[model samples]
Target chain A: MSYRKAYLAAPLAALLPVQAAAQGIDETINTIFADYTGWYVSLIFADLPGTNFSWIALWLVVAALVFTFYFGAIQLRGFTHSIALVKGDYSDPDDAGEVSHFQALATALSGTVGLGNIAGVAVAVGIGGPGATFWMIVAGLFGMATKFTECTLGVKYRNEYPDGRVSGGPMYYMTKGFSERGLPGGKIFAILFCIFTILGALGGGNMFQANQAHAQLSGVLGEYPGWITGLLLAGVTFIVIVGGIKSIAQVTEKVVPFMGIFYVIVSVIILLMNFDMIGWAFGQIFMGAFTGLGVLGGFTGALIQGFRRAAFSNEAGIGSAAIAHSAVRTKEPVTEGYVALLEPFIDTVVICTMTALVIVITGVLNIDPETGLYVWNSEAGRISTEGEVAGVELTSAAYARAFSWFPAMLAIAVVLFAFSTMISWSYYGLKAWTYLLGEGAAKETTFKVIFCLFIIIGASANLGPVIDFSDAMLFSMAVVNVIALYFLMPIVKRELESYVSRLRSGEIKRFKS
Target chain B: MSSEVFVVAYEGAQDDPGVLGYAMQRAAVEGATLLLVHVLEWSPYSFLTPEELEERHGRRAKEIERARSDVTGPALDKVKAAGIEAECVIRYGNVVELVVEEAGKAGAGMIFVGRSGSQSVAARVFGSVPMGLAQISPVPLVIVP
Candidate 1:
C-alpha cells in the first residue's frame, strides 16, 4: 500500500471495535483514539512539499547578496560600530528609551537563539551532510543586512503611547510605513502581520520551545513523566514572564551570557579533543557544499537545508527581533540597528557553527560499507529515521567520547540552555499576544496561563505535529514581515542618515567618561 | 497661590547643566521652590564590600552634592536675579521610585522630565519607564522632549 493509504488505513482499522466490545466501549475507544490519530495524520499530511526549497534557497542567496550591496555592506562596514555598541562605548544615561544597547541585544538574541540552533542544525547535517555548515555560515553573513533593515524600521516606526510606553515592530511599520508610502492595503497588511506574529509566537515562540525542552527533559530524566517536566517549566516561566520585559531582560541578561559562554566553552573543549579530525571535517564541509556526491540533488539539498536552518536560527529576515531592538534606549534608531546586525553573527555564525562542527567532527555521519551512503547505526545513538536523539545526546556522545564521564555535565548544560531559551521565548510570545489581545488584565492573565499550560502540553503530549506547525508559522511570519520591511526601507534610510548626521555634527557625543 | 515644581536629572544630564538652569527658571516664574534631585542606580555587587560600598557611596554623595550646589548656585542666582526663592534636594533609589518619592517629599505640585525624542507613541507606551509612571502617577508629569 502507498504510504498515505497505509497511514490512513492503520488508524481506521485500529478504531474498529472488537466483536465482543459494547457500543460504549466503541464510543470511548474511538473518542479517545480518534482525536490523537486525527491530529497526527493531519500533521504528517500538512508537511509542505516546497518547504525543502531546492530553488528558493538560490533566490534567498540572490536576495541576501542584493541586500548586502544595497545596504553598502553594512555588516562589514559597521562591524566595528556593532562591537562598540556591545562594549557600551556610546551608552548615554540621557538617551531616551528603555534598555541599554547590550540588554537590547541580549533580549533580541534570546528570541533568535533557541532550539532552531540545536535541533534544526542537527537535522540539516543529518540530511544534507556536513557541507551544509559552510552555506549556513554564508547565509548567516549575508543575513546581517536583512537584520539591519528590519530593526531600523522597527525603531523608526515605533509608537510611544501617550503613557510613554513604546510599542514597535512589524505591526507598526506595516501600517505607518506603508500609509506614508501611499499603499492602499497598509492597515490590512499590518493587521495580517499582527495576526501572523501572534500565531508565530504561539507556535514557534511558545509551543516549539516547550516541545524541545520537554524532549530534552524526557531524554535525560526518562523516569519522570513528561507532563511533570512541562509543569515545572511552566511554573518557572510564569514567574519570569509575569514581571514583563524588565524581569525578562534581567533574567536573560544573566542567563544568555552564561549559557552562551558555557555552550561555546564545552564545544571548544570537544573540538580540541578531536583535534586531528578538525581539518578533515572542514574539508568535508567545503567539498560537500559544492560538489554533489554523484548527483546534483545532494549538493543542492545540502545548500537548501543549510540556508533553511541558518535563516531559522538567526531569524535575521524574520523581523521578530526588531520588536526587541525597538525597545533600546537611544535617540538614534540606527544605533540600535547597528547593534542588531551582530545577532545573526553570534547566533548562526558563532554558536551554530560550533554545534555543526561538533556533530561533523565526531564522525556521526559515517559512510555505510554496503550502501556507500552516509548513515548511522540506529542502535548506536545516532540520528534515527524518527529524528529522535536525547536533547544534546549526540553532542554529549561526542564530548563523552573525548572526555569520559562528561555526559552528565553536558546534560546539565543542555537543560540550563533549554530552560533559559524557554523563559526568554515565553516573554516574546506573551508580548505578541499582548499586541493582539490588548493589555486587559483578563486577557493578559488568560494568555499567560494558556502559554504556561502549553509548556505542560508540549512536555507531555507528542509535539511532532505541533512543532512542525509552529516552525511553519515562524517562517510564514518572516514572509509577511520581510515584505513589510521592503516598503519601510525609506524610513530606515532616513533614520540612518539623520543619526549619522547627528553623530558627525557631535550633537550626540560618544560617552567619553 | 503658585505651585511648586521639581526637576530631576539622571547621570548623563550633568554635562549640559542647561536642564538645571531651565528648571530653576520655570520655578522662579511660578514662585515655586525648585528642587534638583540626582539619583545613583548602583548595582548590588557594589555592596559586597563594606569598604568599597562606603567609598563608592562617599564619592556618589560628593557628586550629588556638587551637582546640587551647581544647580542651586546658578538656580538661586537666576532666582535672586529674578527676585525668587529656590532650593535643591538630592536623594537616590530606583530611578522611577526615587523620582516619585522625591516629588512627594518636596511637595512639588508638578514634575518635569526630559523627553527622548523621535519615537512613535506605541514604543513609549510599552517600553518607556516615564510613560509607565505617567499612566499611574498621582501627580501630573510633564515630559520635556
Candidate 2:
C-alpha cells in the first residue's frame, strides 16, 4: 500500500480497539439503563415497525396534508397575498413588531436554505434516483401550507417584552394555544417541544452548520488542522450573533440573497454549458424515479430515499422556520403566514431543483443494469472506497468539471453558505433555549458559548450518528407543531376571513398616511 | 376639578381618528385642555442642522395639521357648535419616549393613542405595543386595536 493509504489506515485501525473497549462499556451501561427503563424503551421502540414507511415521516406528511385541507388550501389561495406581503404593499412603520417582511423571510430562509439543498439533494438523487425530486417538490408544495399555519400560530402566540422586543416560536404556540383551548398536558407538550427544539438547534442547527462549514473550508484550504477553521468560525459567529436577530437579519438580508443568486447563476451556467444533456438527464430522472432502473430493492427504496432527502432539505412541515417568521412586523397573522408559504417554494422548488439538475446532468454515476448498484469508475480516477462521495465534494467535483478552476470558487461559496446558516441557526437555538431557561443574561450567555463550542466539536469529530439523531429530533418537533395547528385551525380560518374581507373591501387600500 | 387627557391622531383612518378628535374636542369643551403631539422621528443623522431638523419637523407638523383638520374639521366644527376648544402640538424624538415625555410636559392625566395595527399579521396577534407599554409606562395606556 502507498504511504497515504498506510497513514489513512492507522487511525482507523487504532480506533478499532478503542471502539471495542467502548462497546463493552456501552453494553454494560445499556444493560443498566435498559433494566431501569425497560417499559419506557419498549413503548417507544414498539412504535417503530420495520415497514417501508417511517411512521414519523408518515405522521408528518399526514399532518401536513390535513393542515392543507383544514386551512382550505390557504397556501394556494394566499399566494398573491404572500407576494404582497413580501413587496411590503401593506406594511406600516407604526406596526407593532421588529423587522420587515422581506427580512423575516430572508432570515427564515437562511436557516433552512443551506447545505441541505446541495448535499442533501445530491444524496437523494444518488440513492432514490430522479423521481425523488418530483416527490420532494410535491412535499415542498404541501409543506407551504404547513409553514403558513405554523407561522400564523407563531405570531399569534408570541410574547412582546416591555422593551418592545419579541419572543415566539413553537414553544409559545404549543403551550399558550393549548392552554387557551383548555387542553390537558398543554404545558407538558410545550415543555417537550422546547426540549426538542433546543436539541435540534444544537444538533441540526449548530453542529450541522459547523460541520458543513468545516468540510468546505477543509476541502478548499486543504485540511490545515480543523481547529483553525473552527476557531475562526466560532469567533465570527460570536460577534454577529451576540447582537441577536436584528444583527442576524441585517446580515442574512445581504448574505442570503447574494449567495442564493450566486449559486443559481452558477447552476444556470452549468446547465447551459451542458445544454444538450438536459433532455437526456431529465429522461433518466423520470425513468429512474419510477422504474428504479438498476437500483437494488426496486422502486420502493428509491421513493423512500427521495422523500427523506426532500424533507430534510426543505423542512417544510418541521416548524423551525416559524420561529424565525414570528418576528415579522405585520398586524395580520395570516399576512405573515402568506409570506411563510414562499419559503418552501424558494427552498425546495427553486434551490433543490437547481441542485438536482446539476447532479443529474453531470452524469457521474454508472448503474448496474440489473441490480442498479453504482459501478465504480476506477479508470476515471474519481471513484473511492467510501461507496459515495461526500456531498460537498460531489458538488465541487461537478463544478470543477464544468469550469476547471470552479471547485475553488464552489468551496468558498460552500463555506459562506454554511457559515451564514450556522449563525442563523445559532439564533434559532438560542431563542429556543431562552424560552426554556427564561431570558436571563447568564442563561443567554451560556447558550451562546455552548453553541460556539459545538462549532469546534462538529469540525473536529465525525457527526454521522449525531446528525441522524438530530434530524429525527427536528422532525419530531413537526409532530407537536402540526398537532397544535390542527386544533387551532378555527382561529386561522377566522383570521383568514377577516384579512380577506379587509383586502376585498379596500380597507387596506383606503388607509391613508 | 377635572384632569386633562391628550389624544394623538395619525393622518388617516377616519372613523377612529374622528372619534379620537371628537373625544379630545369634547374634553376641551368640558373645560380641559387638549394637546395633540406628533413626533417626526427624523434622526439627526439625516440632516445638516437643527434648522433642517426643524424644517423636516415642520413639514411633518403640517401633515399632522392636515390630519388634525380632517379629524377636527367637520367633526370639531360640530363640537365647536357644541362649544369645545382644541389645540395641536408637534415635537421630535423617539415615538415612545416623546409620547411619554410630552404627556408629562403637558401634565396630561391620561394619553389616548390609536394602534396603527401591525405591518404584518404576526405583529397584531402578539399585541406588541400594548404588551410593551404595559411593562414600563408610569401612567395607564389604553391601546385601541
Candidate 3:
C-alpha cells in the first residue's frame, strides 16, 4: 500500500513540469517526436518506387492475399464453421477442460474495435472518399485469412509455464517455427518483432488512443490543455495497471462490448433514417473506390488509403491479435485461429463499414454537386469538409448531424475506448517487454510505469508525429510477422486440413446445438 | 441391485438442504442411491479482460475445487453418514440443463429439488432452477419446500 502511494505520487510529481511547460510543450514534443522518429516513419511508409502507394501497406495487403490463397480462401470457406465455433456449438465440456475462447475473442474485439472503427475509417473515407470503404471491406475480408494463420501459429508455439500461465506471439513462432525449419536469423527476427511490438504498443496502441481521447474531449468541453486530460487519464490508468485493480478493468471490459453493440445500433438507426440515400451512398463508395472520382491520386490513392486504414483498423496482418488469441484455452490450435479470423470481420467489415457509411450518408464530406466528386482540399491534402475536421473530429461531426447529443456521447465513447485500448496495449507492451528482457516483478513494474507515463505524453502531444511514428512501429511488426507467417504457414495448413477433415468426417463431435 | 437413483439438486450450503434430507429418506426406504448434482452457474460467453482471460484456466480449476470441498464434499459426507449409497457430480454450466442431463445419464428415478421460495425478480423472471427442472426433467421432479 505504501508502494501504491509512491506510484500514485510519481505521475503527480511529473505533472508539475508538464503543466509548467504546457504552453509550448505540445509543439515541442511533437517536433521532437517527429525529428527522432520521422526518418524511420518515412522509410516504413515510403511510397513504392514510382508510385504513391506505401510499401508497408502493400506489404500487409500482399501477405493477406497470399494467406487468402494459401488457405484456399479459408475466410470464406470457414465462415459458417467460425460462427458455429464462436456460438459454442462445437465446444465439448469434457474437451473444454479450460475456459472457452468466446471470451478471448470478445476481449480481442474490444482492443481492435475502438478508435480504428470510429476515427480511422473517417480518415480513410475523408481522404479516400466513400470508395475507401469498399476496399476496406475487401482488405478486411482477406485479412481474416492472415489472422487465422498467425493465431494458429500463436497457439501452437505458445510457452506454457507450470503455474498454468501461457505466453505466445509472433516472437515465439518466429524463433521456434523457424528453428524447426532450420531457418537462419530466427532469433534476430524474434528480437526485431519484439522491439517493434513494444514500440507499436506504446505508439499506436497507447499514445494514438490517448491523443484521440483528448481531442474528442476538447471538441466537446471547449478548449483545454491536453496535459490536463493526459494527467487525469494517466493517473487512473496507473491505478488500474500498477495498483492491480481488476474491478475497474473488468467493468471497462464489460462495458466495451455493449458500447460496440450500441455503436452499431446507432449507426444502423442513422442509416435507416436516411434509408433512401443508402443506394446513393453505395454508388458513391463503388465509384470512388474505382475511379477515385477526381479525388487526389485517383484510383491508386483510394486503394492505398483504403488498404492502409483497413490494415490499421482490423489489424489483420499486424500480429497483435495473435498475442491475445494465443492465451485462449484450446487443445486444437486451429479452433482459436477460426475464432481469431472473426476479429477483422467484426472490426473492419462490420463495424468499420458502419462508420464509413454513416460518414458518407451524413454529408460531412463536401461534394462538388455538378461533378459529383469529393472536393479535394489542396491545402489540407484531404477532402474539404464542413468544419475542415479530420480523424475522430470528422466522425464526431458526422454523427452530430444525426443527433445533436451524439457528440457528447461520442466523447464518452472515445474516452472509454481510449482507456480500454490503453489497458489492452499495456498488457501487450508488457508481454513484449518481458519477452525481450525476461519476466520479473521489477521488470514488469518498470514497463507499467513507463506505459502510464506515455499515456500522459500521448495525451499531451500533437497527433501528427505521434500517429506517424505509431503507425510506422505497428507496420514494422507486420514486416517481421508476415515473413514468419510465410515460412510457418505450412504447419497451419496441416493443422487446418486435419481439423477440417475430422470435422467433416464426424470424428470431431459437437457437444451442443 | 437397486436400480433406483434419486437425483438431488444440491443447492450448496446456502439453502435448507431439506431436499437432500427428503431424498436421503426416500433413498433409504427404497435402498436406493443418492446422486448429488451441483451445477455452478457459468457461461462461456461471459466477457473478461485479457488478464482475466489469461488466468481463467487457473481460476476455473480453483472454482471447481472450492465447489467440491465447500459444497458437494460436505453433502456427500452427510449422505454417507446416513447409511445410503451416494455419489456427487460437479460441473460448470446452466444448472437445470446439466442437472437434468446428469439425472438422465444416472438412470434417475426421481429428482429432488429445494425451493428456496425466493421472490427475487431475477428468479421470477428467469425462473429458478426448480422451476426449470419441473419443465424439463425427464424423471419425476419433487420440489421440497
In order of appearance, the predictions have TM-scores of 0.69, 0.69, 0.95
Q: Which residue runs of candidate 2 sit more than 4 Å off their true CA positions?
A: A1-50, A93-98, A242-253, A368-388, A510-513, B1-145
Candidate 3 ranges with C-alpha deviation above 4 Å:
A1-21, A95-97
What range of 10 consecutive residues in model 1 chain B has the weakest lDDT sum?
B45-54
Where model 1 places Cα greater than 4 Å from the true spot, the runs are A1-63, A96-98, A223-225, A242-253, A292-296, A369-373, A376-391, A404-406, A461-463, A501-508, B1-39, B42-145
Q: Candidate 3 residues B59-78, lDDT tens each? A: 77787899888999998999
True contacts kept of each: 0.00, 0.00, 0.63
Tens digits of per-residue lDDT for model 1, A181-210:
888777777667777666676666766666
Task: Name the top lDDT candidate.
Answer: 3
Comparing 2 with 3 on TM-score, the higher-scoring candidate is 3
Model 2: per-residue Cα lDDT over A1-513, one tens digit each: 446445544544554555556445434543553354345323322333766555666676787798789888887887877887787667763441235677677767767787888767766665566667766777788888888888888888887655345667778887888888887776777777777777777767766666667666555544444455667778777776664434443554456667778888989999998999988777766776677655543465566666666677777767777777776656778888899889988988888888888877775655555765455334532222133565566666666667766766666666677776776667677777877788798898898888887676555544344346456667667667667778777777788889889889988762222
- Chain B TM-score list for all models: 0.62, 0.58, 0.95
Error of 3 at B66 (Å): 1.9
Q: Which of the predicted structures, 1 or 3, would earn the higher lDDT when compared with the native?
A: 3
Best by DockQ: 3
